[model samples]
Structures are given as structure tokens and as C-alpha cells.
Target: MRAMDEATVRHVARLARLELTEADVRRFAADMSKITDFVSALREVDVQGAEMTLHPIANRNQWREDEAQPGFKREDAVSNAADSEQNFFKVPPVIE
Candidate 1:
């Protein structure tokens, strides 16, 4: 893969609303180039017939027997709230 260029870095910075200096663009381009090289090197690996392994741990769906359990009281659940009204926790308004 070709190394990422200054133009591409500058374009990306603009899209992200970043104010990158020339030095910042050059540094980011160098880092991106190294990442591209690593990915390109990975593409050359032989994985034919290799099963796709999702997780490193081989254990699959080891679950305990489901049973009814005691649940927490409503008051206990909201006991630590800074503000509570009508049996529910009240939080600061987030949206206008």
C-alpha cells in the first residue's frame, strides 16, 4: 500500500474540524504510513483453510442454571440518588 500523503492528512484534518499545523500534518502522515505498511504486510500472510477464531478463550456459552432470585426494592435502588421524586430518580435536564 502506498504511504498516506500530506494532502490526504490535511483533508482528513479538515473533515474532523482540526486545526493542524504543517508539522502536525507531516507527523500524522508518517504515523499513518507506518500503520498502512503494517496492514499491507498482514495482507501477505497465508490464512487459507485457517478457521476464523473470534475469541482467544475457547469456552463456549458456559451458563449456569436459570432460577428465580430475590430482586432489589425500588427504594433501595434509588437510595443513593441526589434527587428523587415520585419514586424515581431525578437527573439534571440534558436537553432544552
Candidate 2:
């Protein structure tokens, strides 16, 4: 596998909105290069008869019954709102 270059690392950082120093770019370039090299090595492993599994360990979801519950009053819920009307929190218009 080709080594990860500084240019690629910088481009990825830009896409992620990261502010990286020159040292960070160089470090990430080396780190990503190692990762790709390891993955390349893994590609050579024999798995012709290996069974695909979603997870290493077995897991199951616990089911629960749905139940109705009482909640806070409307007045109390909106008590901290800067502006409210008709039991609803009001905010500035987002459009226009």
C-alpha cells in the first residue's frame, strides 16, 4: 500500500473542519500510512471458508411493555422560555 501523504492528511483535516499545525499534519501522515500498511497486510490473510458475523459476541434486545406516564404541566414546562404563547415556547422566526 502507498504511504499516506501530507497533502491527503491536510485535505482530510480541511474536510473535517480541523485546524492542524504542520507537526499535526506530518504526524497524521505517518499514522495513516501505518494503518493502511496494516490493512494491506491483513488483505493477504486466508478467509475462503470464514463465516461472516455481525458481532464477535452474541447479543439480544430486551423487550419492554409500553406504558403511559404523567408529565409536567404545560405552564411549568415553558416557565423558562424567553417568549411563549398558548402553552408553547416561542422563538424568533428562523426564515426571513
Q: In terms of lDDT, which candidate is strongest? A: 2
lDDT of 1 at 88: 100
lDDT tens digits, residue span 1-96, model 2: 899999999999999999999999999999999998988986888989998898988889977778767889999999989999998999899899
Question: What do the candidate models score in CA lDDT, each in turn?
Answer: 0.91, 0.92
- Model 1: which ten-residue window has the lowest total lDDT? 59-68
Candidate of highest TM-score: 2
Model 1 lDDT at residue 89: 94
Models 1 onward score TM values of 0.44, 0.53
